[model samples]
Target: MGELVDRVDEQDRVRGVVDRGEAITHHWLHRVATTVCRDGEGRILVHRRAADMSRFPGQYNFLVGGAAEVGESYEEAAARELTEEIGVRVPVRFAFKFLCRGEISPYWLGVHDAVVRTDITPDPDEIAWHAWVTEDELREMARRPTFVADSLYALDRYLSRGEAARADPLP
Candidate 1:
């Protein structure tokens, strides 16, 4: 068995447990948690996926996170991912979630936001390169083909919501 995740229905309700790989291979909906880190000035952190990653290698995204564990709530998973991926431990607020038709798989993406008041220590296994860019710069990044489509979708939704900070309206 691979990493266990809670398989979910279209309504985002827990259905059963499944291997992460199997869920992706079969297009089963599972929970993914991502945190968009912003500095005090609101510049967003964008990063390139590691070249050695099994998925989306060298691709770009405005967030950093991963699949939620079997019983982890979206917020817990987002906080956990922020620590694991970038070594930043801060309180993350629920921004929103949407069903993203990913380039490689389909999953319910729970997007969160964090203000990085301290330094970051990125995991080389997950992030290759990172930089903070203004929202206008991030808006330009959204047009790149090398970027993760699902991430762009998240970014688009996040920006469209008016306030950078908001709670998830989905159940």
Candidate 2:
């Protein structure tokens, strides 16, 4: 069997459990938790995904995250994904959630924000290339041909919140 995922409904309620592969194969709705990571300088972390990844291979994504497992809250999933992908265990605050009409499958995306006070150890299997960029640089990268579409959506919504959204600004 493959990784188990929590299948969700239109309302974002858990409906049942399915293997992540099955969910993707059948186009079942699931919860995906991701984060926008920034450094102390407020530069966003942009990464080129490893080309061997099953989903969005070799794509440039601003958000780093994956499917929420069964019984995992979006926040929990976000924190876990951060640690798994970027080797960070910092406090991740929820930013927003949206149903992404992804290119491969549909899923609810839970977006979070976290400031990295420490250096990140990116897993080579997940991140092929990484660099911290200013918002303007990110904006330019977003226009690239290989950028992930869903991540672009998340970035748009994150920016829509303006500077007054989060209580404490990025450290």
Candidate 3:
């Protein structure tokens, strides 16, 4: 049996449940959660996906997460993914959410950010390599094709929002 995931509509409303592989193959809108981990020095954690993974194999991803299981909330999925992919359990802050239409999978991506003070033990099956990189360094790496598409999109959206927020101060 395959993993069961929640199927969502264009507006992110839960439609029903389906197998993860079927969701990907049919391009069904599904729930996905991603957690971006950062250190005290402001460096972000980036990891290379295992070469055998179905999507974005061997590509660098700044976020660690996966599809939300049936009946799981976005936050729950985010925290669970963080712990499963990297051996770190920390409080994650909700960052943003967006509809991501990728080549292999279309999902409603729930993005979260966390400051990890604990040590990380990446799962060898999910992550090939891991590192801490400055924002500038991440941007440089993202310019290449080695980075995951959805991650780059999410990062760009997050940074743009940060810039806009910094530019417009509340009176």
Query: What would the TM-scores of all predictions be?
Result: 0.94, 0.96, 0.93
lDDT of each: 0.89, 0.90, 0.86
* Model 2 per-residue lDDT tens digits across residues 36-60: 8888877899999999998899999
What ordering of candidates by TM-score runs from best to worst? Answer: 2, 1, 3
Deviating ranges (above 4 Å) for candidate 2: 166-171
Ranking of models by lDDT = 2, 1, 3
lDDT tens readout by residue for model 3, 1-171 = 599998889999988989989999899999999987888776889999999998899999898999889999989999999999998888877779999887678899999878787789999999999999988998898898889988877988877776443221211
Cα lDDT of model 1 by residue, 1-171, tens digit? 989999999899999999999999999999999998888777889999999899989989898899999999999999999999999889888888989889889999999878887889999999999999988999898799989878888887888888624433222
Task: TM-score for candidate 2, please give it.
Answer: 0.96
Show pairs that collide, candidate 1.
none
